[model samples]
Structure formats: C-alpha cells, structure tokens
Target: MKTVAICSGKGGVGKTALACSIAAIIAGDQKRVLLFDGNLGLPNCDVYCGIEVGCTLGHIVRDGRELRDAVVPTKAGFDLISGGSGWKELAQLEGAEIDALVGDLMVLADTYDHVLIDCAPGVGNRVFPFLRASQGLMVVTTSEAASLMDGYALLKNAWDVNPSLTAGLVVNHVGSPAQGRGVASEVQGIVGQFLSQELEYWGSIRHDSLVARACAERRIFASAFPTAGPSQDLVDAANAIMGLGVEAEATEEISMLGRIKSVFGKKTEDSEDKAA
Candidate 1:
C-alpha cells in the first residue's frame, strides 16, 4: 500500500481539492482508498466531498472511539477520516501521544491500497505526524513567491524530520501555461539543488472559475462537473500517483486454468483430492 500525503505550507492552495481528486480516481479504478482530512482546525473536506461526518479523527482521539469507526464514506466511493474541529485542540497533543495516534492509523493500511492524507496548512504538529506516517509527500503550491517559498520550507522541514521521505510537487492555480511551467521549474530546482531531493512533478491544476463555484456549492467540482479543466487535471494527477511504478512481482506466472485452480486450491476438499 502507498501512503501519499497532499499538503501545503500555506492554506487556500487547493490542497484538499487535489487530495479529493486523487481519492476519487483511485477509488474509481477499483483500488481501496482512504483519505484523511488532516487539516483539523479548519476542516472543509466533509463539506467539499458532500459528506456529513458522524465521527472525525479528533472525536476518535478525544471522545474515545476506535480509529476504525472514525472513517466516513463519501458519495465519490472513497472513505474520509477528519481531524479536530476546534483550533485549541489542534496542537494539544504531546510527542508520545502523536506517535501512538499514528501507530493506530497504520492498521488501516492493511486494508487499503492507497491512503491519501490532506494535511493542514503551515508547519504545525498536525502536518509532521501525517508526514511521518506517509510513504510519499506531495506539496501543493501556487505561482506566488510566498507560496513557492513556503513549499521549500515544508520540503526542508520534511527532510529535517525524515531524510528518506520522497516528495512530489503539484502546482495549483496556474493562471497561465507560462506561469505554470515557471512555478514547476522554480520549485523543482530548489528541491533538487538545496534539499538534494528529486521532486516528482504530479502536474498542475489550471486556474478555473469552476473550482470556486463548486466550493460555493459545497461539492467537489470534479465529481459535479467532470469535464472542467481542473477536474481533468486532477484525474491526470491521480494517474501519475498510481503510475509511480513501485516494484511488486510474483515469483511465477500461472496459466488461466492454473489461476482458476489456485482459487479453489484453498478448500479442504481440494486439498484432500490433491492428496488422494
């Protein structure tokens, strides 16, 4: 299973949008996907995905619910686990508690092929723990200088906390094609040169009025519109994630009959027949 985090140093960069899009595409492809709305204090995932949550990550931790019970299903065929709603509770955990919390989250990995975490903006405690649990990190940024700088800062933080963490870049709000390429090049250069990390360009979401429109309607634009450029770009980004091409190989190939036989081979009667 691959644990991918969609995070940004600053908020309002369409991080949740990118995360939800990835979750939708992964689920659509028949892959079991779970998305955690790690942005606890300013939680909007439930609203964006049109899900009314009975339980959130904050509730599970503070209210004494099991982690399994915190996961809520959305209309897009994916699961969502949310974070704390109250700002005071967001940074209210100690180091040990954070460690224990992440340990519990690992159990879900066994049941999912992809777990996409939508981390909160800025370098907060909430962001790092999620980053630690993740196998790969994708930083969402815009064309603004401050956003680019924050993206680098987040990359630096990730490296400081975990040296082996692989990172990806998803440029959002590209007002123009030229500006998009420049943003990608600038961010990728900083990561490659200063951090000594290869930044995976997961593609960009062009500036679209539909995005804001959907947010106003409190729904994922991708699922609602389906044909919007931003929505299409998000699907391409999800494909890029799954197509990362991690190595997994079986020892040998089985024939069609052998494959069918293998399914039934687990039966006690089949075992007896083979012995006989």
Candidate 2:
C-alpha cells in the first residue's frame, strides 16, 4: 500500500478535513483505502466522517485488543482506525512501542491500495513515527506567516529524521489559486535554499463556506457538496497526490524495525545537539 501521512505544524489549518476528503474521493473511485486517525491526542476523524468509534488504537495497545477489531468501516467507503483522544498514555509511547504499532498495521497494508494517516499537528513524538513509516508526507498550511513558518519547521524535522523522506506541500484556505501557489512557492524556495530539500506542490484547497457547513454537519464536504469549489479543489489535490506515484515502489526498502531505529537514532542526535 502507498502510505501517506497528512500533517501540519499548527492546528486549525483544516488538516483532518483535507485528509477525510482525499480518502473519501479515492475510495469513491473504488480503490480500497484505509484512513487512520493518527492524531493520538485529539483525533477527529470520527467526528468529521460522522462515525461513532467504540474501540480505538488505545484498546489495541493498552487493553490488548486485536488490531483488526479496532478497524472500523466508515460511511465514506473507507476503513478507519480511530486514534485515542485524551489518552496521555498513548502520547507517551516510546520508539519501540510505536514500531510495534506500525508492525501491527503492516499486517493490513496489503489489503488496501492506500493508507492515509491523519497525523497530529506539530513536531511532536507522535508525528515522526508515522512520517518515518510513510512513503509520502504531505504538509498542510495556510497563507498565514505563522503557518508557513511552522510548516517549514515540520518539513525540516521530518528531513532531519529521515533524509530519504519524500514530502509535498498543500496550501489550504486560499483566496485564489495564485495566492496558494505563491505561498507554496515561498515555502518551497526556502526549504530548497536552506535545507537542500525540495517540496512538491501537490495542490491547494480553496476557502469556501460549504466546507464549514459540511464540517458543522459532521460530513465530508467533498461528498456532501461534490460540486462546491472546495470540493473540486480537494479532488484536484487528490489527483495531484496520486500523480506522485507513491505506490510505484517495487519493494519495501524500509521495514518497520528500520523505521523505529532511524527515528530513535535521530531523537538521540537531536538531544545531543540541544545539549551541545
């Protein structure tokens, strides 16, 4: 499966909403898609898709529940693994524990065409494991200066951990397409110049009231308002992401164990840098 982690450095930038819409769009095309709400501290995938989640990853980790049992099918035609909200224990998971979780997830990888992880915003511990495991990392940001700064920070952190990590940028809530492109260009230019990293502009989502209304109704805006501007924007973004050919790998180059080791190794280096 092509694993993609959707993350942002700052919250309230409509990261989860974009993830749900993209997953729904792909699933609507009859592709088997698995959407995991990896925002362990504050997951809202269930709320966005209007599904009631009984068991979560927390049950699997803490209570020894089966991973497959925690996989809940949503009305959007995709399977969802809901993350635990207010579960501080999950936030404290060590590198080995995170690898164990990814190991369990790999069992279901062959069953789906795509696995979209809606990661929690920021450069926190919970974010890197998914980034390391994923073949593609899409960072969502708005036109605001703070959002762009933080988004670049997130990209830098991901690259620092795994230099081989492929990443893209998605500018959301833009007033115009040109505006979005400008924002993406600025961020991409900075990353390329300073970090020697290139960020592909996957696409952008337009600012529309329909998106807000759909979210308020606890439904995916793409499905609820298919013809809306924001909906079409999401469709275009999904198409761009698919064009990246993240699934074209002949073999898995990085195993779960490798991911864990890489992440932990980077953590140690980062701590040392701080101490220096």
Q: Which candidate is the best by lDDT?
A: 2
Residue 97 in model 1: lDDT: 76
Q: Give the Å shift of residue 104 in candidate 1.
A: 1.0
Q: Where does the lowest 10-residue lDDT sum fall in candidate 2?
A: 245-254
Give per-residue lDDT, candidate 1, residue 34.
92
lDDT tens digits by residue: candidate 1, 1-276? 788878887988889877887788789899889987777668778878877777777777777778999888888888888774664554576667777777788887779888888887888676788888887888899888899899899989987887777787888998765677777888888778977888877778889988888888888787887888888778767876776535331223335567778677768677898899
Model 2 misplaced regions, further than 4 Å: 246-276
TM-score of model 1 vs. true structure: 0.85
Q: Give a tens-digit lDDT track for model 2, residues 170-206.
A: 9999998899889888888999999998898888888
CA-RMSD of model 1: 5.6
Q: Which candidate is the best by TM-score?
A: 2
CA-lDDT, candidates in order? 0.79, 0.86
Model 1 spans > 4 angstroms off: 87-91, 248-276
Consecutive 10-residue window with the lowest summed lDDT within model 1: 245-254
